[model samples]
Target: MTEPKAIVSDLESFVAIAKQVIADTRDKKAIPGKLKPYLEQLIRHREWLDERFRQPNPDAFAVYTLHQEPDDSLLIMSAVFLPGQGTPVHDHAVWGLYGVMENQTEDTRYERIDDRSRPDYAELRVVDRRLVRQGEVMISYPPDQDIHRVVNTSDKPTLEIHVYGADLSKLRRRVYDPQTGRVKVIQARVPVN
Candidate 1:
């Protein structure tokens, strides 16, 4: 599947293709894996991303909604990372696919090492660190294996695409502190969907 069967050169085309893929997958948990190849094709093409989403914010990083399914069953988004801006360790609590569109970024994945006895605290250990360059994608699976942080290692702005099984901005997800071993719930405010 290195070459696209149909050219997904625009947002609408990509969304249509994605919605079909989502519908074809019988197991809801497999949506991210099923969507990865199309997203990779989209990443390699780069024509589907908007020009406005390629710019970085001056004082902070920015996240923009590309599209969301009508039933709120899917969300596609773009994120612009300013130089040196990085996300804290967090979990999406749902399936997701992250594809790098322009430039590159770094991802740090952590593994929870503690027993699940407490709700407000977790002991974590660094499990993986890698550079996800342009045309690359990463997956976040819920319940486990979704804890990670992303950083813009480049000196200029970098753009990345995000596709989640649900509207992540409205969900109360978990945020972690490695230093204090603390956990907090946060609902992110995002650009209009």
Candidate 2:
């Protein structure tokens, strides 16, 4: 239905809970049975978070931290995409999950192929493409697993709830050359006064 009021307070709290769940699983070498329900609840919460993104306002791109420790981190990201707003092909190094709140989005996955040249780079070839709709959850892994791009394919707008395993704002995310697959880490720009 709708996102609960409590989940919107801050992103750090959501990250904390997610990190705790991840830690509990790693420390015990397996996910504890008790955490199963919590995981499902988080998934449901993610769905609700996405609902808040169904508008075309950039002001709606509210991101909150769920966790930010050295070992593990989590973030609850809400994004409202206007028509034609899309991301360049890139990779999220850590694991992540996203729930679509409204409308639909298109995701295209690529395969990295090595190319030796003056500048060593990887070539990307589209291997899979999918159209995801409302209430759908997409999960991804790191490295060679899930290099892809996301786009809102609707005339109106779309909303999505994203759960990241790391602090993406602080991390150096890579953007790949769609044709050459050359990898370059994107740095944040500091605005001058």
Identify the leading candidate in terms of lDDT.
1
Encode model 1's per-residue lDDT on 82-128: one tens digit a residue: 88988888988888889988889999999998996999999999999
Q: Runs in model 2 with CA error above 4 Å?
A: 1-17, 27-72, 115-120, 188-193
Model 1, 65: alpha-carbon shift in Å?
0.6
TM-score of candidate 2 to 2 decimals = 0.68
Q: Stretches of candidate 1 above 4 Å error?
A: 1-6, 189-193
RMSD for each model, in Å, please? 3.0, 6.9
Q: Report how far off residue 86 is in candidate 1 (Å).
A: 1.0
Q: Each candidate's TM vs. the true structure?
A: 0.90, 0.68
lDDT of 2 by residue, 1-193 (tens): 1232234223344455555667655533122232323333454444334333344556322333333466545555566667766677877766767767667789889877664363436677898999887767676666656678887777867666666666665666677777655577764211001
